[model samples]
Target: MSEISNNFLYEAIDEDIASGKVKADEIHTRFPPEPNGYLHIGHCKAMIIDFGTARKYGGKCNLRMDDTNPAKEDTEYVDAIKEDIKWLGFDWEDRFYYGSDYFEKDYELAVGLIKKGLAYVCELTPEQFRTPEYAGNTTTPAVSPWRDRPIEESLDLFERMKNGEFPEGKYTLRAKIDLASGNFCMRDPVIYRIKYVEHHRQGTKWCIFPMYDFAHPIQDALEGITHSLCSLEYVIHRPLYNWVIENVDLDYKPCPPRQIEFARLNMTHTVMSKRYLRALVENGVVDGWDDPRMPTLCGLRRRGYTAASILDFIERIGVSTSNSLVDIRLLESCIREELNMKAARRICVQKPLKVVIDNYPEDKVEYFSVSNNPNDPEAGTREVPFTRELYIDAEDFAEVPPPKFFRMKPDGEVRLMGAYIVKCVSIEKNEDGSVKEIHCTADLEAGNGNPLDGRKIKGTIHWLSAKYAEDTTLVLYSHLFTLENVADIPEGKTYEDYMDPNSALRIEGAKIEPALANAEAGERFQFVRSGYFVKDTKNPNTFNRIVSLKDGFKA
Candidate 1:
């Protein structure tokens, strides 16, 4: 928190508090997400700001479900959202609310607008009033035909609409704001629309539902949210937001909520839209919303990302009003930074090749001392079992060495990490000409720094004793898309056209050190030379690579 030096939202709030527009000790904020889909990585940014800002000011934040359109909402999403927020370490206390909880208040406010002649029933169809009025800041005003409907008649219609008298789309209550204004949102925007569909929470009790623009301000006003933080797309809607608060008669709040906009997080290789993500799930392009390749919070969590790591990423990105694309590597850097300190060091040869120590007695088994975490002396050490036969990654050997290639070629010497230096004697091949086994002889006294072991082995590799290794699987993940921005595809080609074919690569029967056989679910480890990985929650003996040991994405 001390590292964050400049934030416009905080600056704005300080000025508001100074001006006495907001109470010094009563500062409140809210995260009003519609219960339509699972919260993604982008929503994490908003959550931190809304929850963090209130916390910073020694106040509270509310978790409000702005569920006006129940057509797309469900209790499933509501529960999931709450879980996600709590998982990220934020609390709303007893301030949890739904927009429908204030339906009575919203309806009364709408009636007040009607009584003031500020709102009227609109008879024009969505098509008739669908003029591109907001485009280029100069669209001709296309007023609704029922703009001047008599107060008595419109009030009766509105009441009947609430009583389920009108069918869907027969009439809409629109705010009678400027018709010729440059901003189309202020140009008589619809405040309420009649929908016969059943609400997830309200059921069939409400046939006429308040639009988002109408419900949001009322919700904020009722909750006394001093600062309404949102993404930059809501910047143009600020005036409309204030207009609703100004026109509505509400006594819950002495001051309207201050609307502040900041840039949203956008990454290079992932799409942030729920609709697109849903398509991927429904089409079986990905396993589910929690698929590791997905950018959703659940997906990242399942992919072995720590909550602290995500928070670190958010802090590094900072908050701004200007939109920009963040390099995905920074996100990876967050994971790498956090995991390096805690993830225990282990030896796991992903693609194992049998290496037999021909000079060692077959009945002998030795345990070697290795530091668990070199940076933390208190972490101490553990003994890894070593046997006459062991397994190393197949890539560590080359039958015909390339120029300057060092690791275990025939008759080449190398150091076995945490064990003795060994010299390869011969290579065995299969009928298909593939190398089957590597035969080696270890310098027995080398690991203890004996005088006979004086050598600089440039090729040091990790290994696991075949006898003490557990048969495991490693599930590696790559970017979901091949293109830098899926939106940059050629004409007629959809975002799925760039779906990465190698997004997930699974290796079976991989050998992991026996000590990890019972590693708890969600436990993380650094596969010595490979990467950071976590034990899969659903699949036993299966692990998911959180990230490579180093950054691979440059741009």
Candidate 2:
């Protein structure tokens, strides 16, 4: 069970079951996606509702592929979609389905519609269908020349269309709805078309395919889906969805499916359209769908987002009818909250400055016990080696300290985190006027227990021994786009126009504590005073900073 309370969608399902509106054994749902592109963050919300709702009711949820359009579908996308759903911690088990598998049944249904005068073969070109003057308004429809064709002739032509007798777009099977109906979709929408192209799955089996509108409801009904949830865009198609089910004759089916629409997830600073995201990949705007900057599920997983964190985010956002943009900060906050309690702590310095303890013995080295997680005592501690020579963040030291600076400065004192307090006495400068090395004297008694006693430090900073620190690579990722609302761009300019040029920055050399030397890929850690980072699976030696520590000092 989820830690958060159930939202309205779940509440509705619970009520339906309690009132006997939905049978306990028939409350099945499905996540039907077209296998044409990778799943993005927007898809995550729908996935949660589809799978999560079913689990709550002890019902089954199917992961169905709406592969009606073969031109854009591919096995690559199918595999990626499966992998993404698994990563999100949802399983369809053996309930996987594909609309292409019902091609024959769909075609037969189209023929039946034609013979019953419910559908007809249309010869109208695409241009004539969309022309403003010829296209009718709410009260009228531009009649097709082929609407009055004889039923037997239409059925024979439809069979020939399926057998590859006609070229692509030369003929179509359209429903014979009210020509003067208020809803334009009721004005005889297209049911099937000739495409001559080979399908990825069915490959050359048939040239004609059923349209989404005509195929989806039947597919849902055949699979015993009780509720078909979709985005608000499908609300208008509800009438057509039911119309097809009512017109078609099914053999002993329990009940027809019901569809409910909700607003799609709209995220700030990100574009959800697959076409726009594809443009980013094809035009070199991003490396690929898995680029850490992208909103794709794979990208978020690679960038260190956890399944629990994503679910928590979805719950926090909740389900609503009104559309609004969710702030990216809310998503980051969920990650931070989850990591704060689980991710181990380590020390890493992006820009290193050498610090030498002058009074300490050159060959002497000791280990300090540091807590793995300060919030959880049972997590225990690990020993970190401390030597005479060490490395600290370059920004932690200043030759001439500012008014409020409390870190390492000449004649000033600061404590090395989990170690002894040290007073900086002098510094070595390079010919280029950059600080080469900082010299400090340690207060032994101030650390554990020694001769020199009772000293306090105003500031503390993290460090790594020069001999134990490992040189590693680091990658920093930022927002993909610079604009807050990518969909609201200027006319003529695309959402990609707002893509951030500096979304990813690669660092060749970074100093990390010995603890991270053996860290495996996909491991997450919070570098003390630095940020939360994750080991990159694609590049084992590389680590990506998910987000920096919140510094109240910075605006």
Candidate 3:
């Protein structure tokens, strides 16, 4: 496990404790995500901070669903969020909650603000409100004809709105804060709006929903969150959050939750936007949310990333107040480093080419001992079958070898991993001019040892007995987008313009050894000289390449 470095986020908490503003043990944080889509890699950073801080201070963090808007929210997303968090090794204990759970209190607070003359029901259409006449300038305040509606009238209209008496755009409840404040979020932002969509949890019992800006702070305070950690995009809304905390008369809680902002995670070659991801799924550009190519947590998990590796990546990147694009290779390197030490070794021949040992007995089958993981002695060893006919990756052989190529060539000698050295003596070509079979003579005296003459063999390759190999599918993945950073797409170009057409390549009928047929879904293994792969949970006889064997990232 990577240790958490001392960053400004922790420094702020330290200062709070030093100043007696908040006790170290009183630290409380919340990860409130809108359960409208699957959680992606960007959410992982926030999740770490939320849970890591609580663990650091012996405090508690709550997992709350910011499901104020019911349009896209669903119990499916809610369940997925919890599963992803737990899979990442964080525990919320008994602190799971939903924003809609506070809907009644949100309503009561809005009404209280109206009676206090700090809020009113507005009738301006969204478009009209955005017009220059209503969108106040620095000198001119925003104009709202209903800004001064009587408290009783606003209260009655709010109740009627809740009763489904009005259309979606007919009315909105807005806080009567400054209309010309430098921070526009305080320009009487909408506290509540009419949504006819059925809430995933609340059902049709309520027709109006609270906007996130209004509902979030209240939810934080109600949950007794001492630190409301969120991405840097919400920094501008800090004033509004503080304003709500000061004005709202939630007497039950004496201390208001403090809002802290940190930069969100952005990675090269992939996007974290839920809208873009949803479009990818909807347009059939990708398989689904858990498609190994997507950046969603489930997607990464399916792609064979471990929770510890992800946490290690997060620790290496650390927390930053400024936004920057991190190299995806850094993440790949973490998984590679982890799998190199942990994943068991297996033989898989993608694009198999037959190698017939002409000198070996046709009825004989020999087993050679091979280490399951060379880096892990306790992982033990497994026996691999070697027979008269074997399958090696077609790429390992080249009839006309390129310079510096050390694999198989005509009349060349190569060592079959865990077995004897074989010399390619003859080849048979198919009608398509491709090598159909390579007839090789195995040195029987070499056996599982080496050549008796001590002649060096330049090439070594992995192979599986053709008779014992199981046909399986292998899904190879690459960058989803060709662009280094999808965020830098040209002004008029959409992400689709940079989407890689061959992001995922599926190879069917790939030959895997009999040992691999017993691999359970999600079990990871290193394909000798190929890459790391994991069995697909939703597919039969299929594996997904987690990452290639090499990356330039040093850490």
Candidate 4:
């Protein structure tokens, strides 16, 4: 929605509607997710495309839960998914659905398939079915001995299976496709399995659950979905998808819903696998699903990533069929661009070093005016306390100046941002030989527009009045993985092997200007030259650095 250019996905939808392949009234789409885990960034990309496409075409989008595996599915995940979708600025508007809601209809459809001799009851256990000897090549699918059973017996067994007559995994309803088809999915894939576990949504209403391949196409058709878009992995499954629709007798066109595949989003330095992410949580490697290092939407939100920024990121990435690893810097760039125009400018020193103005009166305190945002004049300005004692970043003062370092050093003169120019006179060292503090003398005569102030200083540094500055905590976050291509690790090593141990650093004893004392949670600001940061919701006083200001001079 933020001034995005035309892409193939949009062009295809437009062409379809213009060519009468799809009518405006029939342009419904749905984002079908399995409610087994938290939605990640990859899922976010799909949701934006799914809902964005529908909305642009004056169609409605449905949020459907593919709650087929009750053992791993739960209402917690269902609720989280909905909350995330809403947070991403999308709404399904009462078009919410669940695959479990069609249990009765799915059962009847399975029964019809049995009556048509296109499906049968297979007694093979999962272990035996997975064996190399049992699972032959696509040219020679190992025939199931039970496939020859009569339709009446198959139908009866399927009913008994649903009624809990047999234990879980004893029998399964499989499509009676070719035994020697080129496509492996067409070689008698499993359509239904007997699972005695209670469903999160339906409770104990049914024991037989439809597989994704069996339920997805039917649900799309039932919801009148015109564009059944999915990732490229489903390309091989399309034949079977159409087979089910064609075989099922329906009042409307059986194959009106078409499935299209696009390459999924993959980013460098981050693992998108939900299973691995869950392992990180379960093993205590990270805090939880919302850990700042995670790629989950909740994690991004907690890390001060605005929904608008994420939407902008998705827009920049666009839709593509070819796969590529997007640099994480691009995401950071998008966030920086958004925050620069919106976030207020403030001052906070992560590592504080005491600076004493020797010549200034110790009891005196004055207010220095500073602009809230230089980009917008109407943003106004606020006054910050200036006193004899102040705290500057420890790195700002170099005991021995490095080459090209323009910051404070012995005998160096610098402007104390918004205050008078000061020249360092001497350094005080502790017993440990560490520079404890730096003493400077402010040139009071060189006030604003003074004749002597015509001279320029190469360095200008931000500081907070030591007397009025508040002590607070600050969190600095970095990339989760050390390596760019986490998936390309050594054979035995996993993506976790490349996890960065210093991805998050919590710093205490940080000092902020008195103006930031009233900063509330969810408020974002550019912390002077430090970086763009936001107040943590969990701890209002604590600020988390989102991204640093770009240093164009850096190679």
lDDT of 3 by residue, 1-555 (tens): 422578788998898888877888889999888998999989999999899998898888999999998999988999999999999889999999999999999999998899999999999999998888998877888889998899999999999999999999999999989998888888999989998998888889999999999999999999988889999999989998998888888853435788999999999999999988999999999889999999999999999999998999999899989999999999999999999999999999999999999999998999999999999999999999989999999999999999988888888899998898999999999999989999999889988787899898978999999999999999999999999989988999989899888888999989999999889999999999999999999999999999999976675
Alpha carbon lDDT at 37, candidate 1: 84
Off by over 4 Å in 1: 1-5, 131-139, 252-254, 447-453, 552-555
The sequence of per-residue lDDT tens digits that candidate 2 reaches over residues 449-496 is: 332644456788899999889998998898888888887898998765
Candidate 2: deviation at residue 213, Å?
Answer: 1.1
Q: How accurate is candidate 4 locally (lDDT)?
A: 0.86
TM-score of each: 0.96, 0.95, 0.97, 0.96
Q: Each candidate's lDDT (Cα)?
A: 0.86, 0.85, 0.91, 0.86
lDDT of 2 at 467: 87
What lDDT score is found at residue 217 in candidate 4? 84
List clashing residue pairs in candidate 2: none
Candidate 3: the clashing residue pairs are: none
Query: What lDDT is reached at residue 140 by model 3?
Result: 83
Q: What are the runs in model 3 whose C-alpha is more than 4 Å off?
A: 1-3, 252-254
lDDT of 4 by residue, 18-89 (tens): 887877766788999889888988898889888987887788899999997798898989999999999988
Among these predicted structures, which one has the highest TM-score? 3
**Candidate 3 backbone clash number:** 0
lDDT of 1 by residue, 387-481 (tens): 99999999999888899998989888988887878899988899999988999998876654542735678888899998889899999999999
lDDT of 3: 0.91
